[model samples]
Target: MDRNFARALSLVLKSEGGWSDNPADPGGATMKGVTLANFRRYVKADATKAELRRISDDQVAMVYRRFYWDAVAGALLPDGIDYAVFDFAVNSGPGRAAKYLQAVLGVVQDGRIGPATLAAAGAKPAGVVIDALCDARLAFLEKLPTWPSFGRGWSARVASVRRQALLISAAPLTTTVSVPSAPASADAVAPTAPPAGAGPHTGAEAPAAPPESVSPAKAAGILALIALALGALTAWAAHLPCNLLGVFCQ
Candidate 1:
């Protein structure tokens, strides 16, 4: 509500030019065909539309609460950037703009846009689109007689909201497990250690030692068993006789 804050905000938004052209700009020249009173009437009528109402203050505030970062202070970005991002979110949907900002800022690439993404975006070099938007907001703000005072209050609110957004965005993320070693080789197996307080043999009965060598016949028998099980399953599935049907099917 500080007048100075509004003035500063108005200055920043006014400096950016294209904002006056926004469809939401109450005084846009594009709406000149309609009288001011008629325009207001149309706005009131449109406000009743479900889609417009869906994008009401509550929805916008929800999104604002998600991305507004205050703690970093004004150092992360100018007041214009905050206004621009919020407007972009409201107009284009927060998810898309957040993703675009993430891409612009080189943050995590998951596209569900949010505060961390916007903060990251603030770190990006201003591009053509960003510059144009900043210009528009600045231009729009500058034309308003009350902009100085209004902008100050709006900027303060934005700052507070941004702080909340940052906190939400900074919440601890879920963690994942990490294995310390590579998978064991096909031929390698885990070694069993002797139990505590035992002699060389150990306290409890020692595990059976692994075989030093494997016989070809034993391996062949194991393969035969596996083949038999697979044959049975195939026979059941095909509803065929086990032997001849199995050979033909293969």
Candidate 2:
């Protein structure tokens, strides 16, 4: 694997406390504390002592495989897919991560960590998820150094790897491209127009017809009609031919 890739893998593994000589035994550890031993057992529920040892070996190999290293031949990953797969494996376990990649790539979601699935893992080219994992690993490393004596070496290794991963992640493969400017042409220039009606254009809105003003005489005529109607009502009330008051009294 590339030195950078190896360094990154080592850092992640170290951050997780997977590289310790006195690695915790998975069999008796409680899940609550979540020591390396418990984590291994959580991933490999049915393995025996010998089998458990083998799981450790598998874990290392899976890490390399996902991160672009050939465990048997000792080769480095040649593509970003390996990095992504490695990250997913580290976060979700090899089996579950492979399954997710398969589902994302639309192959099969059998949860088997294999070459085809690893190949599919690279389908999403952007390294957002892997970068996120790297960030997490860095944070874990920063805190690991303050942990108890038993974790010192592991913590140191994690811290080292975290620094390396950050460096690698910093040098992104993709770059942003600026939009090209159009050439200045005579046709592109907007023409200047003369002010208002001075040129062939008139920018002013036409004057609206003045609202018909009500004359005082027209208003007085309406008032006079109303007054006349009121006067006729008063005359009727004062004893007209109908004589309503006289009839009521009778």
Candidate 3:
């Protein structure tokens, strides 16, 4: 197992708790965070509800690893980043988790974690990425039909995930466990503060982020497209057959 895998899973389990068969929950039944359907697919093809309830630690670990961790390519991701994406994957689907990760990185949202996505992620500070991703997660969860029923626990989980992810990102990892989180309300949400032991906020604040990188290829392609459009317009205005850019000027 990767070093961070165990740490991340441990934190997630706290929010999952024992056995839950809440009818309102679409997951139906979950044990140690693994839904029965997933358990059946992974551990036992014909697994019964009884088997899911009796799911062991080892089985839980396997399901998480194959379905969640590997799906997000967690091993290649940075410390806290891996946990953030991993938790989101467990709660949401891995594809959505990957897309969320991509969205925050400002890369193409292809719903797959690959080299381009990793490059974009590594360019930004992990803390910033985690905060952005958590904010996006909360925004999305609030839109769900079930939000009225389960929003509180989801909020709490997001808040806890954001804080703990930041902790592990900065080197010397904390042994302290994290609870689920977000905010009870806009007025009630406590802002995430700097980690302990950092002295008062002195000195000038960091400068604004630099501009997006220039893409010569994209620029060239766009310029070519513009030229084609211009040519098509000229052809149309002149009442000639339109051939430029496949723009039909009948």
For each of the candidates, the C-alpha root-mean-square deviation to the true structure, in angstroms, is 24.0, 22.4, 33.2
RMSD of 1: 24.0
Full candidate order by lDDT, most accurate first: 3, 2, 1
Model 1 lDDT per residue over 1-250, tens place:
1212333333333332231234444433222122233233534444433333234334333323333222112224434344445444433344544454455456785655456755665565434335544444444455667666456644454444344334322332323467799776655543566467646543334567787897999999999999999999987777555454556554
Q: What is the lDDT, from 0 to 100, of the residue 33 in candidate 3?
A: 90
Could you arrange the candidates by TM-score from highest to lowest? 3, 2, 1
Number of the candidate with higher TM-score, 2 or 3: 3
The TM-scores of all predictions, comma-separated, are 0.25, 0.31, 0.68
Tens-place lDDT per residue, model 3, 1-250, is 2679999999999989989999999998999899999998999999988989999999999999999999999998988999999999999999999999998998899898999998888889999999999999999999999999999999999999999899889764556568889756534533356578866544435335569986999999999999999999886677543554566664
lDDT of 2 by residue, 1-250 (tens): 3444565465455445423234443324222222335445445565444444344544654445533233211123224434444544554355654554455566777865456654544344435434444445445435643445434554455345334544454455545668999886644543454366553424443345569999999999999999999999997676654574356431
Runs of candidate 3 exceeding 4 Å displacement: 172-250
Clash pairs (backbone) in predicted model 3: 155-181, 155-182, 156-180, 156-181, 156-182, 157-180, 157-181, 158-181, 159-181, 159-182
